[model samples]
Target: MNRIDGGFGWVIVCSAFMTLMLVDGVLFTLGILYIEFLDEFKEGKGKTAWITSLIPGTMLTVGLGFGGIFLSTLVCVGHHFEKRRSFAMGISLSGSGVGIFVFAPVVRILIEEYGWRGTLLIEAGFILNIIVCGAFFRPMQKQSGRTTEKSETKEEAIDLLRCDDNLIYIKENCIPSDKNCTIEENASQDDDVHASKQEIITQTKSTKNTTLSFFSRHFDFGLLTNPIFTIFVVSNCCTCLGFNAPYVYLPDRAEEKGMNKLDSAFLLSVIGISNTFGRILFGWIADRKGVNRLLLYGTSLVICGTVNVMNPLNDSKIYLMIYASVYGMFIGVFVSLNAVILVDLLGLERLNKALGLLMMFQGIATFIGPPLCGKSYVYNLY
Candidate 1:
C-alpha cells in the first residue's frame, strides 16, 4: 500500500496503544504497589523503592536496548505514518495515560481484595496481551519489495559486469577513444579504469565493514555525538530525576495528608483523566503549523515541576485533587510529545537509536530518582 496518512497505520496505532497501555499503564501503578511493598516487606524505604524503580528501569534499559516491544511497536507505527506521524504518536502514547486512569482504581480494588502479590499475578496475565497486539504489526509491503529489488539489482549489476560481452561493450562505449589513439593515451585510460575499479572495491568493503560495526554495538552510542540529541538526553535525565517520583509517591502523599487509601488511589485516576486530555490536545497542537513542540514540552515540564515542588504544602483533599489533576495534564503533555519532539529534531531514520539512548539515560534516572525520594520520605518522617 502507498498510503502514509492512514489505513493500516491506524491499526498499528491501536496496537501501539494497547501495548503501551499494558506496559506503561502497569508501570505507573507502582504508586499503589509502593504502599503495599512498605507494609509487606517492611524493608528500608530505599530498599523497597527498588521494586518499583527496577521494573521500569529494566523495561527502559534492557527492553529498549534490545528492541523491546514498546520501541518496536513505535517503529512500526512510524513506518506506517508520515504526515500525520505526530498525531498518531500522540494517540498511541495517550494509552499510557488512559491506562493509568483505568488501572489506578482497578489496582486499588485488587490490592484491597487480593493483596499486592495476587494483583501482580493478575497484571502479569494482562501483560501477555502485548503479544496479541504484536500480531498487528505487518511490515509495509512496498518497502520490503524495494529492499529486495535493490539487492537484486546490485547482484544483477555485479553479474553483468563480470560478463565478457558487457565488459567489451563498456570498453568500446565508455572509454573515450579515437581511431589514431596513441599507446601512451591508451595506457593512461587503462590505468584510470583500474584505479576506478579499485576505488569501487574499496568503497564496497568499507560499506560492509560499517554495516557490521553498527550491528555489533548493543545500542548506538554515536547518538551521543549529536549536540541536539545530547542536550535532549541531559534535559530528560534532569526532568526524570523528579518526574516519576510524583507517580510513585502521590498516593502515599495523599494518605499521609489524612485521605483514606481508596481516596488516595483516586488521585492517580484524576491525574490519568486530565493526562489523557492533555496528550490528545498537545498532539493536535503539535501537528499545526507555527507551533514549536519543544517549547510546548518545556512549558509542560516547568508547570509539572512547580506543582510537584509545592505538593508537600497542600493538605486539603480538594486542593490535592486539583493539584493532581493539573500535574497529570502537564505530565501527559510531556510524555505524549517526548517522542514526537525527537522525531522533529532528528527525523525518523535515527529515531529508534535516539529513543533507545534516551530510554537508557532515563532508566538510569528512574533507578536513582525513587530511591532518593524514598530516603527523603524516611528523613522527613523521622
Candidate 2:
C-alpha cells in the first residue's frame, strides 16, 4: 500500500519497463518499416513521411498518443519510486532501449517474412499489450489535495477503472471515481440527493468539466511561466527534433551505401543494445551523491548530438556500426534521465503534468524531425 522503494514499486518498474518496451520498441523501429514503405510506395521523402500512418510522423504519433498511454506509463513508474529512484527509473526507462534493441531486428524479420502491411498489423497487436500494462499500475495512496490530484487520478480512473478494480480504498466522497455513475444510487438512497433538473444540469456540467479536465490535466499552460521549465521544454524540443532522425535515416543510409539490408537494420539494434547498458551505467552513476542530473542530462545530449553530427562522416559499414554504437549509448542517457531530470527541474508534485507537457512538445518535434531529414535528402540539402 505504501511505497517502501521495493515491493509493488518493483512491480511498477517491471510494468513500466514492459509498457515502454512496447511503446518505444515499436516506434523506434519504424525506420525498418519505413524502408519497406519507400520500396513499396516509391513516394517522395516529405509526402511519404505522413505515411508513418511510421512511414515518418504517423507511426511515431501512434506510439506516443495511441490510446494516450505514453505519458501515464512514463509517470507512474516514477510515482512508485523515491530513494533509489534514479536507479529504479534507470531500470524502467531502459525498457525503451531494450524495446529498441529487441524490436529493430525483430520488426525487420517480420517485414521480410510477412511484408510491411502484415508486419504493421502484427505490431498493432503487439502495442495492444500496453493496455494490459496499464491495469497493473495501481495508484499510490500518497497524500495530496483532492482538486489538484483530480487531474491525474480521474485520468487513471477513466482509463483503468480503478474503483471497480477493488485494489484501492475509497475513503470519502467519490474521489472522482463514479460520481455520475453513482448519482442515481445516491438520489435513491438519500432524499437530499433528489433526482431533479439540477441533477441534469449538474451532469451536463460534469461532462464539460471532464473534457476541460482532460485538456488542462495533460497540458498545463501555466508551466510556461516557470522560466526554467520553459527553457528546458524549449531545449528538449530542439534536441528531440534531431534525436529521431538517425533511427529513420540509418537503414536507408546504409542501404544507399550498399550495406546489406539485414546489416543495415542491425545498426538500430546496436544502438538499442548500447543504450541498454548506457542507461543502467549512467543511472547507477547519477544516483550516487554529488552527480548533477541536469548536468548529466546536458552532457549526454551533447555527446549524443555530437555523435549525430559525426555519423555522416563515414559511409563504411564498420564505421557506421561504430557510430551507431556510440550514438545509441549516449542517447540511452537522454531517455533514462528524462523522468529523473523532470523531477529535479520541477519536483515530484509537478511531475505528471510537467511530463505531459514536455512529452507533447517532444512529440511535435518527433513528428517533424525525421520527415524533414528525409526531405533534405530529396532536395540534396543533407
Candidate 3:
C-alpha cells in the first residue's frame, strides 16, 4: 500500500470538513436552540436540555457503533496518511470548530428571523450535505499480490486432488468392471474409504469451529485489562460529564448577565476561531516537535477545565469573550489531538475498537451531562 496522501486524501479531508461542519456545527449551536426550546415548548430547563443533548448523544453512541460518517472519515484518513496523520486529522477535526464559529451566528439569525422550528428545518437541510461528503470516500485498493496468492493456493489444491488416485480407483471399482479383484479386497477398500470420509468430515467441523474462534482472538477483549487504557476511558467519561453543558448554556448565561443575544452568540464564534487555530497549531507541533502527545492533551484538558469552572465568575462581555477564546483554543487542542493520542497509546491496529468503545462510554456521559447541568441551574447548584 502506497498512500497517495495529496491526491485523494485531501479530497477526503475536504469532505470530512463539510461533514463535521454540518453535524457538529448544529450540535454546538444547540445553545441557541436551548433558549428557543424553553420558550416554544414551555418546558423546564431540565426537560428541554434533553432535546439538544440527544443529537450528540445519539450520534456519538449509535452512529459510531453502526459506522457513522465521522468515524468512517476518521478511518479513511488514518488509512491514507501515516507520516502526516496528526496534521491531516487536525485539519479535518478543525471543521467542528469552524462549524461552531460559522453556525452559531447563522443559527441565531435563523431563530430570530424564522423562529426555532424554521431554524431546525434549515439546519436539517445543511446536515443533508453529509451525504454528498460521504461519496468522496473511495474504497482503498487491495494489494495486488493477495489475489494472486489466493489463486495459487486454489490451483495447488486442485493439482493435489488431480494427483490423488485412491478416490478415483474407488469410484472406478464401484462401476461394473471386469477386473479380477477379490470380494475381500473390495470390502477392505470400502472400509478404508469410509474411515477417510469420516476423518475429513471431522476435520471440516473442527475447521469451522476454529474459524469462529478467530474473531474472539482477533478482537481481543483483554485490552480492557490494561491500566492505562482503562484509566483513559474513565477520565474521558468524566470529562464528557461537563464537556457540553457550557456550550449548551453559555449563551443563556450571558443573556441573564445582561448581554444581548448577538453578543452572546459571538462568544461561540470567538471560541470557534481560537479552537480552529489551536487544532492546527497543536497538530503541526505533534507532527514535527516530537513532543509527548499525552502530556499535551492532558495540559489542554486542564486549561479547558479551569476556564469552564471559572466561567460563572465573569459578567463583563469583554472578559467573557477572553474566557471563551481561551476555552475554545484548548478545547480545540483536546478534540484535534484525541485520536492521535489514542494512536500513540494503543497503536493503529487496535485504534478502531478502542475508539468505538471510547465513544460508546462518552456517549453515555453526553446523554446525562446536559440534563444534570440544567437541573443544577434550576436549583442554583452551580
What TM-score fits each model?
Answer: 0.80, 0.80, 0.81
lDDT values, one for every candidate = 0.80, 0.78, 0.80
Write down the lDDT that model 2 would get: 0.78
Residue by residue across 1-382, what tens digits does model 3's lDDT show? 2355676788888888888777788889899889888888898888899998887887777764223776777777776777788898889988888999999999899989999889989988887778888898875676675676556556544543553443322444342343222445545544233435446677878977895576565345577898988899898888898889878988988998999999889888888888888888888888876588888889999998898788788689988998889988888877777777788888987877777677777888988999999999899998
Candidate 1 backbone collisions, by pair: none
- How does candidate 3 fare on TM-score? 0.81
Compose the digit string of candidate 2's lDDT tens values, residues 1-382: 5666777888888888898888889877878877887888888766666555233243223334552666676677788877677888788878888898889889888888999989989999998888888888877876756665556666655643334332433333544444423334533544233234445667888987786776776667899999999899899889877888878778988999999888899999998888888988998988899988889889989998887778778899899989999998888888788888889878999998788777767767877877787788789877
Candidate 3 deviant stretches above 4 angstroms: 1-5, 64-67, 145-220
- RMSD (Å) per prediction: 6.8, 8.9, 7.9
State the weakest 10-residue window (summed lDDT) of model 1. 173-182
Residue-wise C-alpha lDDT for candidate 1, range 251-271, written one tens digit per residue: 987887789998998888888
- lDDT: the better of candidates 2 and 3: 3
